[model samples]
Target: MTSAPPTETARNDDQAPPPEQPAGRRAAPSPVWPGLRALAGLLRPQRGRLLAGIALGLLGSLLGLAQPMAAKHVMDSVGQGQPAVGSVVLLSTLVLAGGLLAGLGHYVLDCSAESVVCTARRRLTHRLPRLRVPVIEHTEPGDLIARVTSDTALLRRTAPQAASAAVTGTLITVATVVMMGLLDAVLLCVTLTVVAFVGLVVILVTPHIGRATRHTQEAVGRMGAGLERTLGALRTVKAAGAEQRETAALHRAAEYARRAGVRAAAWEAVSTTLSAVVLQACFLAVLGVGGARVTSGSIGVSTLVAFLLYLFALAPRVGQLVEGVGQLQIGAAAAVRLREAEALEVEEAESTEPDRPEGDGDETAPAPEQAPGSHERHRHPAAVAFQQVHFTYRPGLPPVHRHVSFTVPAGGMTAIVGPSGAGKTTVFALIERFYEPDAGRVLLDGRDVRRWPLARLRAAIGYVEQDPTVLAGTLRDNLTLGAADATDEQIAQVLRLARLDTMTGRLPHGLDTQVGHRGSRLSGGERQRVAIARALLRRPRLLLLDEATSQLDAANEAALRETITDTARRTTVLVVAHRLSTVTTADRILVMEAGRVRARGTHAELMARDSLYAELASTQLIAFR
Candidate 1:
């Protein structure tokens, strides 16, 4: 379903505001011209096919013109009492040939239009993923989907119909005018006078068509967004019994779109009616003026008949020209929205690895030495250190992290426990570089993380979000998302480590069983385990676990805690622990309140020194025990 266009506030939140128009610059150029130009550019790569289609359309139009002139010859021959059989045959052949050419031309133009839409969709698909995190967060996914699907599809209708009608209609109109002028200059002048007035009317109504079209398209987008919002949280909406309210909201959006569409149709209808009126007016003027001239012996009867035929042909062509302009306006409006989406800032593409040094042949060297008390081979865990980090979601907003400083040694487990909204998750976000700190340095393995290639930096770290996400797919698909090349044996190993092996055996299709949307078919513990297994598949040097056991039962949570502890022997582990039982055994713990670390020590040390930590241990932690 279509949705309303995003509001100015939504657009601004999704992207930086448009640059201010320069002083003295004519109010920002109409979106129509710029959008049309951009739409034309999309076809530039396929111009060969487009031009061929256009040429064929013109050929068809020329052939169509030939039919009227041929009919005039037959009429003239019959008036002279000639046999006229050959002329009749010639006219029949012209009609057949014109139909054939027109059909072929239409087919080719339709294919070209499809190709243009496909190219647009492919570009948008590639571009959307490259957009920054903040932009994606603010923009509705449904609106973006609409742009890729419905908005681009509009171009399929727009490109060929608009181009063919505009080009072929103009060609036919001009050719017919020339033919009429040859028959009689006085009649041609009379016909053109009516056409001139129609042209003025069309020019006056064209802007209204564009404005209405843009509004209608935006309303459709909004409707789609509304539907998406309701459906995405279908359970919540149903549980709250707000279905009627949501449906009413969507109806309002749909009504707005319907009204805008009606307005556009009204203007288009007026334009079309004016074209038809112009044709009838021109025909009357030509017939009356030509009849008078013939009586004066200024033109032959056959010439008058031929001129009228040309005028008859000219009407549909003029109507097509007007309709084509309307289609072009609609297409240009869609193009403007597409262009706006494309103009948003995107993150630079990252390579999989950093550049290697010349003659550096030690790629397979032994792993770096593990920190004290660590016990695991292949331990090359990355040491993370943050120095005075300061960050906020927006400039005017309160900071989420204020001069945060901490370190997690290589190949050891560090736990961060704090009250809600204490910036524990924000710390993970900074380490992942999802958001940059306003001021501070984050180091990985004693080197500034900013200096590492983005892909390399991210590949070296694995993060399991607090609320795990399980895509709608088979167990195997979800497990292999991070490690597509992982072997069956490796998959089994992680499943066992995460304690998901037992559940896998009970499934009807084992690993092949569909997990359903967001793993709705799986138990909460299974879903969490699947998420952990997926992360473990990457074999990351630094693992970030945010409430990894939050949804697990006691048995499952105990198993997961053991897995985390075991994993830390070979990889650096930083966990945001909600239940103190999960982190009491960690090498060190950081107590955070507000946005800063209030204390740092082992569980025993912190419980002895910090009042908040002592209280939390006695309350939340002791209950779990």
Candidate 2:
């Protein structure tokens, strides 16, 4: 029979289960221009390539603009009864050169865009592992993944396309209009009036596109989050026969995304189609006015022809202007998402991480160094002391630790045993500094842990969590995750110490065998052994094992018990104990209830003097494995 489990308090010290967020709700949208500014900032690193693309684009537009004049010259030469060969050749050359340059510029801009996304992704991923525990706890992993993937991808199209179109399209459109004015002022006036009306419509429409795109992206994030939620626990869903239920839930999320996408497309379609329509309207107006002028000899036919050619050229450029504005809105919306991700709370000021590149944490662990008030008193195990500690998961909730205090001497097997909700696991969490105590100091070697640099503090401790997580990788990778520079000799030693050497011999590739996702291929006992072996390889000064032997068989449990007792001689071992066997041999034991230590003694001492300890032991709530 199960005893009342611990209050759970903050949940896993390493993996806090976050509260669910409403799918559609989010922070209020930031202003559009800031996101545009962010886009400009992203482009700054690629400025050299950016400038080259801009130059090529402008050159192409210039060539394109000159083609109308070449056509006019061709008409003039033909009317003059000349062969017109030179003018035709010039016109063909301008068209060909313009197309080639535009293509080259587009390719360059796209390459630069890819670089921008890569940088953004690196920056985001770099911050993720460093974010404060509470921040990650509150934020959705799926949504964060969306920002790194789909959100950054939006920048790829919008960054270069919008910037180039704005610069090159504006210049070319203006030049086209000026040339039209020079050809015939009356026709130019008619065209400007029509263009002005369309401009007003486009301005009104663009904000909506941005709003819709923003919503659409958010909906897409929800869909991704939903899918991740399902896949992350696929086995559980399959076991419960809830596949169709999850399918319907995900379908609803996808439907929301689809509806939002249609809204964005509607706004974009309106803006693009109107821009084209206005140009056509201007063309008809110019044609009618120029036709009357030609008949009355106010303007010659070649002049009319060149002016019409200018209008025709202006159509595409005008469309570019509209498209650029739309893409800018979309890009800015994406930028906002990235900006928010960057703003999440971090574990520290990052002063210690200055030398490392973003996403470079895997390459090398930071060399441990002492902080200002940190101690170097021992060549031996680390001592832990929690004094007058107070903690709550969040405000308006009962405190998880209320004036809780404990001290453990260096180099021993210390077990924390308690009923469910008694906050036993919280001891390890506080010692590791995964959370901060509200009212008291947690000391490592007589120095406040807060005074220690995060990297240095974490480096000194090796933690094997309750329900240990094994990432998808080789057995060697999982074992050496914490000890990045661990040698094969040390790995072999830990494997034998954890009773895994025999298991490895049976495996096809031994230590190199794939563990599958979360070590899905491994049994519960094997996973626990892997977790134990990983911690042992770290060679930590303080080793934390939360229920280290809870999943093992009788043989493995007895073997691991011996291993733990032996390791305690070399480094401090603190365990949160549920099984009676785990606590019986501990050098000392703390019996906790309602967030405070109620008893401290050996098993015999507790059994003799404490009613709660005696009751639990008799009932096997401090369970016998």
User: How do all models score by TM-score?
Assistant: 0.89, 0.93
Best by TM-score: 2
Q: Give the candidate number with the greatest lDDT.
A: 2
Q: What is the overall TM-score of model 2 with all chains considered together?
A: 0.93
What are the RMSDs of all candidates, in order?
A: 6.4, 5.4
> Candidate 1 regions off by >4 Å?
1-30, 351-379, 621-625
- lDDT of candidate 2 over 1-625, digit per residue (tens): 1111122223433222336453225766656788788778878899888888988988998999999889999989988999999889999999999999989998898888899899999999999888876666666678888889999999897987788898888899889889888888999899899889877977899888888988888888888888988988899899999999999999999999999999999999999888878888888888998999999999999999998888888888888888898898899889888888888878874232224354632222222443321244123687788888988766665777779888988899898877766777777777767677878767777666775677777878888877778999999999989778888898999999999999999999999999998899999899999999998887778889988787888899999999999999988899887778878889999888777889999999999999988888887654421
Candidate 1 global Cα RMSD = 6.4
**Clashes by residue pair, model 2:** 5-420, 5-421, 6-420, 6-421, 7-421
